[model samples]
Target chain A: MNEATIQVQKLTKRFGDFTAVNNISFEVSTGEVFGFLGANGAGKTTAIRMLCGLSKPTSGWGRVAGFDITREPEMIKKNIGYMSQKFSLYDDLKVWENIRLFAGIYGVPHHTIATKTDEMLQRLGFASEKNSLVKSLPMGWKQKLAFSVAIFHKPKIVFLDEPTGGVDPLTRRQFWELIYEAATQGITVFVTTHYMDEAEYCNRVSIMVDGRIDAIGTPKQLKQQFESESIDEVFRKLARRATRKEV
Target chain B: MLVFLIEKEFKQIIRHSFIPKLLIVFPVMVMLVFPWAATMEIKNISINITDLDHSTLSKKLVQKISASNYFRLTGLSSSHADAIEEIEFGNADILLEIKSGFEKQLIREGATNVSISSNAVNGAKGGLGAAYLSGILQEYTMEQLAILGIKPVPVIKTTESYLFNPMLNYKIFIIPAIITMLLTMLCGFLPALNIVGEKEAGTMEQINVTPVPKFSFILAKLIPYWIIGVIALSLCFALANLFYGLTPSGSISTIYIFAAIFLLVVSGLGLIISNYSSTLQQAMFVMFFFMMIMILISGLFTPVSSMPKWAQLITMINPLKYFIQVMRAVYLKGSGMGELTVQMVALIFFAVGANIWAVISYRKTTH
Candidate 1:
């Protein structure tokens, strides 16, 4: 079998007395769309952070792009890109400047950065908006642009933590198109979302209930296994199981 | 109706934690640190005494000089040249040269001269130290005349004179000190506020997730302020030259170099405060706290020598104390780099230490 782009072994994270991620293991094949499904405060963000090398897990080990996370964080950071749920973009800077800065930071070759920026903007249909301030852009377009910039360095893996959180359905769909394009280019895309409908777009999805993964499978398979016609119904069924376990 | 509006505004202001701390707590802290820091008095002015003769009178003279508050005897040099080198190397501030057979001449010749060479790179303090030594000699001469039932031998009269800063007006002396104090505010406060603003807008987190080296990020933030600090220092220098006619008598390069070091230290302080604070308001509070403490403890208003011993020790660590000393030495004394090395070293320490602390404290995470 081909090596997994991301490999996790019993990944767990604890914050003092509280565990944010329990012992859970998962692997993503190269160039696949992997959805991290959870509600607010359900450890989706925490798990994504561990995968991106932003936060260290309390126990368990993970490798991204074949680099040990604990031993070579810089190597991991160099190979993966992250876009946060916070609509994270420099508001005071022009979109072009923001693109330039991110590209420079990722150590992209200067000549490539210049040409690639033009190409990316054209591809996103944001060429006319290049000179506009990031704050002036619509929320949807901003999120879409932010996601494109995240993978500007052409990383082996990209983690999007609620990349479409506050955007409308139209923008969210357009953003997923961008994510799919990246995945098709042989870049693995790991994303977290609250939208169950969005889960259907992923090749596989994992539902994190509390700190543990309550269910994981292809969207259609999970739906059929739960005897539900919709991914939302399956999420509800898993969420109910989580609350009952708490009792 | 106006009072009602004012009272409502007051309530809104009071509701926020930073306002009270900035207005009340910070000023008091500044006042406390200012008096502690604002002095140019050379307390513990390390001096090396060269006593050729180990006479009882020479011992008495050494004891008297060391006993005074102006100078601390740091070393006993074997030769007068060694004493001079001590001043040159910055290990000593004043050199007391005692000639041999000094006691026998005082009774027989009735007039004895003791050479007091002070490191006058800080023109005022060096002059003060010299004047103090002369005053002690004149008093001793007076006592001897009274004991011998005689008056001034050959009816000789003494006169004293001062060229610049004749009045020794503290207000003028304090101009440089005030300039140094304001730098900490300008360099440390404004940049700190900008950093907090980024945090408040959530832009800092956005930048953090990028692959930009943290030091480069810090430098880009500090560059604008470092330029502003230089401009501010130039303005202050112009004012000092125009209004007070206080052109630094020393090399202009020395003064600028010292100012650069001082600005770097303040910038580091601002970065550290910015890194630790989560919001603009918190950053402002933190900057306000440091501003007050730095200015007050800078020995701007009070002589550090006059402070309690513990306060004296604290002033030694305050970067403002060294900057003030260096400023006065360069501008007033026309001191060369040789004379101001110790203070420069101290400022360098502050710059490096503060920058290291800021970088270490700056978290490299978006979480």
Candidate 2:
């Protein structure tokens, strides 16, 4: 039962005269941690947005979480959660309040919300600060809490857009641990990040450059194939090759 | 979906420090400014008393004109020369003068002429003041005729009455309009800014990527504001009732129903503004532009009929104009729902149409 949870076939997005996502295709399997690596404006966020049903592709098609992205956006929305790199929590609200709001928006049952909130707070070691305002929390705690809240609805697929952008390396490590935990619990993690070390933790990774995925493979295979010591070096070599081809 | 959005919205607004300012300051400003701005009672008018006859009759006429609430007597000149001076100086709006032998001629021949000159500035106020001055003169002339043996003159006397506001307190006429303005301004400005503020803070991108429906997101944005608007309207109503004795004379339930419709329409306008603007500054400018146009053309301070045809047509499209007219008509005239049907229809049209447009225009992708 290793069927693809997400399937993209010739997906392309255009804005006016400019193309944001060129003819690109990829598939993510169930319970797999798929890392999307790209620099800024690399179409990684655009591709992820298309998969999350937040954006419509100009041509081609895709299915996300067993639903057509184009035809059944609402159905797909119901089955996936999204955590943006911008950290979307309302800072004025208390930590628990933000969680409750997300839970309610996802239509979680009241009893389920209570238990899930309790479990989440306990897991984050934020039990004592549950009632404290979210703005008062440290950046790392907010990031971790944001991730937990995104997956709180038990969505089958979670799209994370650079979820660890500015966090310290230690916090980044903790974030990967949480991602691994979610994956072990059978949640598919679709993450986009600039951090190459984080790419090593994913089951598979796709590196995008200039609106197209330039490389896709396991981290070890990619490094070995590029004759590189790290994922960063492999990405640099691939990106250079892709740019050289453009010239 | 609406419930979910509204719950989060309430939480967000509750934690906002300036919410109390929004609820209290805005309505109070409206209540205070409405009475000052919206009035037909002529003030600072220049009167030129042309005393061609300088007799007690003409002097008494001048005194009577000066004593009335409407006229602001600029100068009391003895000669037509000085009266003309006051009028030409633009210092006086209405000019009154008694022709020479005015009292003796009226007593002896039972007919005397009094000359009146008006500046005609702010033509409406000038014309109204001129008519009122004629009425006052007619009363004085009648009194003089009674003193003499002017028999069987068949005097047609007029007993003056103010239609709705008998006391002629400007505040009474204005509070309802002010209430409508406060709701519209707050609903239109606050929610428009809130959404853009989220975008500015980079939080909207996060919220946008979520599975939360746009309808729910918009509803959540408006719920707290709608509640705040209700509170503000209530407080303004209470203050008006307590301090100004401004009470809704129509069916209170009907007024409230109309008010609720008006609130929804204005809130819909806010959502539309928010959707069009990508930044808080753009939203504010758009809202301010509409608010100014709405206030100017709303018949709040200016008569809709008095405007040019194109302006009148524009005013008809403005939701605030209809709501203000509805509010004033209901509160002062005790007008029935039947009388307010057109206004109610306009409000409903704006509310439904604007909200639908707002919802439809809100794209999941950034432009």
C-alpha TM-scores of all predictions: 0.72, 0.88
lDDT (0-100) at residue B265 of candidate 1?
A: 86
| lDDT, candidate 2, B148-213, per-residue tens | 758535766677899898988878766776787778788778877887788787777666666677
Tens digit per residue, CA lDDT, model 1, B174-274: 76677777677767886677666767776666555555566666666655567667777777666566655666777878878988888888888888888
User: Can you tell me the CAPRI class of model 1?
Assistant: incorrect
DockQ for every prediction shown: 0.16, 0.47
| Chain B TM-score by candidate, in order shown | 0.57, 0.86
lDDT by residue (A59-151, candidate 2, tens digit) is 989999899988878788888988887777888888888888778878888778888898889987779988999899888998999999889
What would the per-residue lDDT of candidate 1 be over residues A1-247, giving only the tens digit for each residue? 3569999999999888888899989888888899999877788888887777677778899998888766666678888888888876777567887777777778887778778889999998889998887889988888888888889989999999999888888888888889999988989999999899999999999999988888888998998899999899999888875642331
For model 1, the superposed segments whose C-alpha errors exceed 4 Å read: A244-247, B1-164, B365-367
